[model samples]
Target: MRCEEGPLSEVYDRLRAEIVDGTLAPGAALVETTLAERYGTSRTPVREALRRLQQDGLVERADRGMRVRTRSPEEILEIYEARIALEATAAAGAAQRRSDFDLVRISRAQKTMTATPASDPAAMAESNRAVHEAIWAASHNGTIVDLLTRLNNHLTRYPWTTLSMPGRWEEAIVEHAEIIDAIEKRDSDRAYELAREHMTKARELRLRIYGDDATA
Candidate 1:
């Protein structure tokens, strides 16, 4: 059966994208009237969008209306730790269970991420997310996909992307390629090792961005 979506879904998608790309930053006010005016729609869709955002952990109710959810530095670090553990497991599963279609989709996502034209930071961030999600889907495990998606949505609360750091994007391209190769070869043990190493190095890079305060 075909799914039917209305204005509410469109509004939700736009708002969610903005939130993920840091356009609607953490703690930014989300008044229905203002959003409706901006989107040139009515309050109904705005309200609906806010509701979905709350469900997605991107926003929270406030006394005035709602606002983008914010996380403390410590909370963000803890969340990354969770992501590292979960994603490594997912990668191992993908190596074991991935189909031909899954491999093709992941390769396409990798190309999108490493586009020769060099996309802007926001586009690059979304591309990075796409690759990770492709791997998650390739695992053929619904539970891990759901867990990783939620963690990633929370991750977007950070204003800066680890991929934007100098040399980081190039480094990630090589790392991702290795991960994909391991999965393609159906080397589950190697995939698990590469996944942990990838995330651990990424965490270290991100911590460097946060500097002394986060590393502590």
Candidate 2:
């Protein structure tokens, strides 16, 4: 049986999309009445949608209203530390368990990431996500994938991409290629080390670019 989407679900999806894509922006006000007017719905559905988003950790209570959640520089660093551990594990698992089909998917995602125009940081960032997601899928670990997905949502709320920094895109391309090579060789240890190094480099660049922003 097919389940039909309700008004609340519709509002939730739209609002979540906006929040994740940086359309609403971190710490942007989310007023029930304003959102209701924008979505052409009553405040009832919008309120429920806000509640769900809050549960998802995408919305937070401000002094007098709801706003998009913001991560301080310290929090962002902590998230990266968690990602570094989990993603390295995923890369090692992929090297050990990936099938031919999984390799094919990963290769395709890498090619897409490399081919994306560097001038478009947004597109490059999206392509980069595809490569990471393909590698995660190759790991065959549902739990790792789910946790990374949730963490990535928080990271993407930023309007800027680390790939936009000078030379970062090129450097990332090389790092990704090396990681793929390690996985293709079925060198689990090598893959794990490479993945950790790759994420650590990214973490460094993120701090270099956004460290000045106290609320980043």
lDDT, residue 133, candidate 2: 98
After superposing candidate 1, which stretches have Cα over 4 Å from the reference?
1-6, 17-24, 33-42, 63-65, 115-119, 210-216
What lDDT tens digits, residue by residue, belong to model 1 across residues 26-106? Answer: 789999878887777888878888987897788998788799987676766788799898889999999999999999999
Q: How close is candidate 2 to the true structure, as a TM-score?
A: 0.87
lDDT of 2 by residue, 1-216 (tens): 212223898899999999988789788999988888788878888899999888777899999889999867786798899999989999999999999999999999999998999999779989999999999999999999999988786676655688998888999999999989989999999999999999998888788767656555
**Candidates' RMSD to native:** 4.9, 3.9
Positional deviation of 33 in candidate 1, in angstroms?
Answer: 4.6
* Deviating ranges (above 4 Å) for candidate 2: 1-6, 20-25, 63-65, 212-216
